[model samples]
Target: MTDPARSTVDLFAPDVAAEPYPVYRELRDAGPVVYLEKLGAYALTRYVDVRSALRDWETFGSAEGTAFNPAMNQNVQGVILTAEPPEHGALRSALLERLRLSSVRELAAWIQESADAMVVPLVDKGEFDVVTELARPFPAKIVGELIGLPPELTERFVLGSDAVFAAMGPMNARTEQALGVIADVLTTIGGITAADLAPGSMGEALYRAAERGEIPPEHVVKLLWNYAGPAFDTTIHAISNLIWALARDPAQFDVLREDPDLVPNAVDEGLRYEPTIQIWGRFCRTDVSFDGVVLPGGSRVAVLFGAANRDERHYPEPDRFDVGRNARDHLAFGYGMHRCTGASLAHLEIASVVRALTTRVRGLELGETRRHLNHTVRGFERLEVRLS
Candidate 1:
């Protein structure tokens, strides 16, 4: 297909955020790359192109910032989210050291225990808002324990995280407001010490890295910010989306209930079907030709995970919410060097919840659902359901 010269899309528009699948289809049909004029960024809609750009971090760099807004993108430099390699390698290593598969596996019992504790009480309630009751509260608590932050402070962390995700999108009332809140969260984080977190928690590990000079002391607080936004927000939304999916299709829940081994697949499928972070940005480091189009140096490119995950070329019946779908290759946790550091932990958390639901609840009756209008994160803010 010939690349369309003009595909102006206000990605942050309420209508688009409310229902983006249609726009995703339009962009994919347009060509390999669609120029979003209002946001001044090229959007990659096809699965192949999106995956290619994510893996090719050298040409499509992160150092210039991944935020859609030029200012936010520039401002986010130096942090793990924006730093390119050698630097990214060092920073990523420090994080992965603590979050490696073996390390995260040790927490499986803790995660299952947490899920059981929260879900057991609610199973008999017959009706509850999954978002606020389970999805929202559960992740905040788990992240709090993982990061060793006080339970009271974890509540504030959720609000701060919402803002951090918002700041990644185009500059507007929402992004501006979130920037202000993030400033305060940063200040609060700057004051944290090892004593502030749980013993042997990720937060303490970060401090140990700083003390050993593996990471600069100044970046310690910034690293804590990572646990707040990306770790908490994405998993919470993924869990919410998963429950909603199962509830919508009771037979799917039965599929898992009959074979609990499918819990992990359910998590992967949920992420693919409705990714939490719908889109992420990358900066072009130098002139690069891709899919018959040259992306000039310094141009911004938006990688639409939502669109890519739904690409029919990659996934058959892309819109179907099937628990058995092997979606491990999905870009929901991203790809390449910058793939999500806490992916193992997220999988454990989501799977634990899925296991608890399938094993405990006889049926899930979904009620009114309300989606949050996040320009970047696509998920529900409210999902009412009853367990019987």
Candidate 2:
């Protein structure tokens, strides 16, 4: 009905990506759908609008690709995040067979064991870099082993995963560099054979599915990329962010340490407070109206998860980080059918670290921290912490 509110916000700018909440709050306050002049896309910043868009896939479609740049969008075409309807469902089903809650729950013991192995020594040492020591290695090891990838390839996948998210933004020098990394990573993955994968691993299972005609033979590589890319990147940042949150407020850590039951609550709150994936792209298949704002057909939409998660209209004291808060409904994982398939495993991995930390570490002190700047995700590249 009315012209959509407009802003010249450059979300992918280094400064903005490092500290985006202020910009996010401004956008959320502007309107339900704010037209981003610089990005040439509409931003859905309110909790209600974002959730609705995610649920209504027909209108806010992912099929045309969800990346801001055309190159990245074209690259994601057949991947689960970009496929529509039947194809999307088929791919999701294959992924769910392994990622189902029941199957993920079975890995809880192994996850906790892995967490303990990683966290305990760091605690005993008094101080460590959370990113390098815990966050990066924990998921790289766990997910890599599960996927049957060689230990060396697992580390390389992390680089590719970061590059994938970085290249999701408008093409620029940063994106160009990321695209180069992605090309090399894809080339490496392309050379792998079934014999290279561990027997009974999820990667091997995908090959078997292709053999059975459950998924296309060619889809195997794309599927592996889909699984490997998001699997480690999101969880790595989440682990670091959660630890950063606790270190920032020792009182919350104490609260968590006292009631181990709140470990799940802490994970949800951490995701809600500092989501790993800050924003994701979508293409409007048709003119979509949110409240009074209209996004014309063919419009590019940026769903601001970070802003919506902290919408004051949705949560009391939205900016405060409370370990007791129940934020399971947060859009950090996205909503509806496209909700992250690895959510359960991510929860398990984050909770494992939280449980391990709360049980052994008495206090946390955050030291020097450097933010990891990517086009879509927010996290610390380096986080120093002292545990006592």
Candidate 3:
């Protein structure tokens, strides 16, 4: 039996954040559930436990707040990310009606064309920071255009979106700064009207839904606030992570070159291999037991997505960066009801970039990389690369 006394680990510690995989392996070996006194939550590490917890929203809830700290958990309410059931359904449907796979598929050609155009200039440049030049800017631009915002506003939109992801952690300096950014974003979103967006854009669609009483008028602002993070940050980091993976393993890039059909698989593997978001918070609404570990009602829990993705129980050779692996079931975008609403759109964007990169560049040479530090998400701040 594992020692229950040694279950706790400070997840927010810098060392763990910098390289979480090693710690994840240790946690998984410890047991399915580890009681983390530091964060006042039970940390679920094993793939089955984490996946089950996510789907059992009734037992492990998000309604109270999905952040580690009470302040954020409480303040983050009313947003789709924190809401439950009928409320969540309303908030999500408002946006998904337009962001659905069929609807987003219409943008596939544009996104591919855009990806090709963004990559063409860099192909000849030989060396470039993928984070700044391609991965970072492209998603923000695409999200802005989709939301009907002017291109100039994309930067601010991205900053605000970053804050959304950062605010998911415990109350700390990062959360403090993120609160300020979120406030500003809300103010900007509150002022926007359907007319401000393109004639038939997602932003316009949201407003039109509000007008039709499909969702609350107040929810229009919430919907706008919601799109910034999922639509921009996660997809941005996924693309960067994919590029890093291919560059780190040229054989994988060669695999892509040989069979462009694997671009979708490549995206899935990237998300599974190096998910952008590391951990997410959920609260127990009732006493829940998993693998003999009983979490009392009202207890907070951390779902370690990064760890679950690499769980040996679910994936053999999980650490290997193999694009051919069937990683479609990974928890990177989450699972069940709260699964990312923009999963299809994010996939489209990532696939477009992969397809374009494989067709254009022969290979990539890694340079110095600077990783971004956020309380919740994992990604690059600077990823230097040289194309051959």
Top lDDT hit: 2
Candidate 1 lDDT at 127 equals: 87
Please identify model 3 stretches exceeding 4 Å from their true place: 1-5, 212-214
Q: Which stretches of candidate 2 lie over 4 Å from their true place?
A: none
Count of clashing residue pairs in every prediction:
0, 0, 0
Model 2 Cα lDDT, one tens digit per residue, 107-205: 999999999998878887899999999999999998999899999999889999999999998989888899889999999998888888999999999
TM-scores of the candidates are 0.96, 0.98, 0.96
lDDT of candidate 2 vs native?
A: 0.91
For candidate 3, report its TM-score.
Answer: 0.96
Tens digits of per-residue lDDT for model 3, 193-311: 78778877778887887899976888787777787756788888899999999999999999999999999999999999999989999988887777766766777888999999999
Candidate 1 lDDT over residue span 1-388, tens digit each: 2443557778788888888898998888877777888888888888998888888888888887888886677657767888776778877887787788999998899889999999987887878999898998888888888889998778778888888789899888888888888888777887788888888888988898889987789888878886666777888899998998898899999999999998899899999999999989888778666667766677888899999999998899999999988988988999988899999989999999889888888879988999887768878889999787
Between candidates 1 and 2, which one is better according to TM-score? 2
TM match of model 2 to true structure: 0.98
Q: Tell me, what's the RMSD of every candidate?
A: 1.6, 1.0, 1.7
Q: Which is the winner by lDDT between candidate 2 and candidate 3?
A: 2
TM for candidate 1 is: 0.96
Residue 358 CA error for candidate 1 (Å)?
0.7
Residue pairs that clash (backbone atoms under 3 angstroms), model 3: none
